[model samples]
Target: MNSAKSPAKKSWLQTLIKNKNERKKVIFIFTISFLLVVAGLIYIPIYKHSLPLDSKIYEGNFKELGSIARIGFFAALAIYPIFLLLKWKPLSHIKKGNFELKPLIQFLAKYVRQWHVPIALISTAMIILHGYMALIKGFQANFTYFSGIITMAVLACLLVMGVKRYKRTDKKWHLKFAISFLVLFMIHATFS
Candidate 1:
């Protein structure tokens, strides 16, 4: 009978309450990512249908590629935050023989933590393709265009830093650059 109530089959909320902070952070990031994508989906058709053809700002000239890139970008944004959750304090407490968690949580965390690098590499490819279509195809240098360039440059620096995994490198720069890129991305997306 105890097997039926095992943690493995518990609702996500139950598992989450046990691993509170990390789960909360993951939920928050997922919520934001979902909202951003949904907002884009809602806004795109309305923008196209409601506005004049001349000012249809985001017909996204490259259509399908643009759509795929936008989705990939939001997905990457969502995945990046989950990295923090992988650093479990419980792991250190294991030596004390006092650790307890659902097997499902353990499995999920391990899978997510292991995939961070791969997710980043995939996101990079999608962003590169998106950038190429947006900036290189016609090569327009404006506020919208330059903001994207700056964001992309910083994002590339971040990827290099992640790959290097330098013990001595100050991590604040990573946080700072990420915030900077986010602001730049907002501006770029808004004006583009």
Candidate 2:
């Protein structure tokens, strides 16, 4: 029999996938990620080498795409603090029996909350595109690619963790993951 005194079965990975919706999210994310990586690892090289040397992204809109991806990366990063603020309600003034800006805070929170998922998805897509392009061209052995891979993978996990309510106390884990990703992303950017 399930006893009341039994401690809840908590999983480190369970925090990342909290609910059915989140499970769906992770599944979709994994699918997309796998396809992109596989294409980069396999299809990209084949397609590139099979084509004429003149037919290349570097010669055309690849730079523009990369720029868009860069912008998306920063945009997603910007959301981290905003998200923390919203979720944590860290403004002490707002909590100390303050009613002057409750509605305003709620309004801002609503907007920021809506943005979290879309921002994560868009940024993930952009990073994948950037990586795919780089890989297609020629994925060399360098810290840049390695760091980027780690960053992107961590970012995906972070997004998945934030997607749904799996555990009540997952915020700390999310925070940790976010910080780790930010650090890794910085390393990737620096090496880039």
Off by over 4 Å in 1: 1-67, 79-107, 166-170
Q: What does candidate 2's lDDT look like per residue over 1-192, in tens digits?
A: 866697788666556655556556656766775675566557546766665535554535444555665666566556556555656544545644645445565676666544445556655665676766766666778887777677878877876666532454566667678788878877776667
Model 1 earns a TM-score of 0.49
Q: Report the Cα lDDT for residue 182, model 1.
A: 66
TM-scores for candidates 1 onward, in order: 0.49, 0.56
lDDT of each residue in 39-126, candidate 1, tens digit only = 6455545664554434334335444454565555555554445555446566544432554444445676666654454455555555
In angstroms, give how far residue 121 of model 1 lies from its true place.
Answer: 1.5
For candidate 2, give the lDDT of residue 187. Answer: 73
lDDT of each: 0.57, 0.63
Q: Which candidate is the best by lDDT?
A: 2
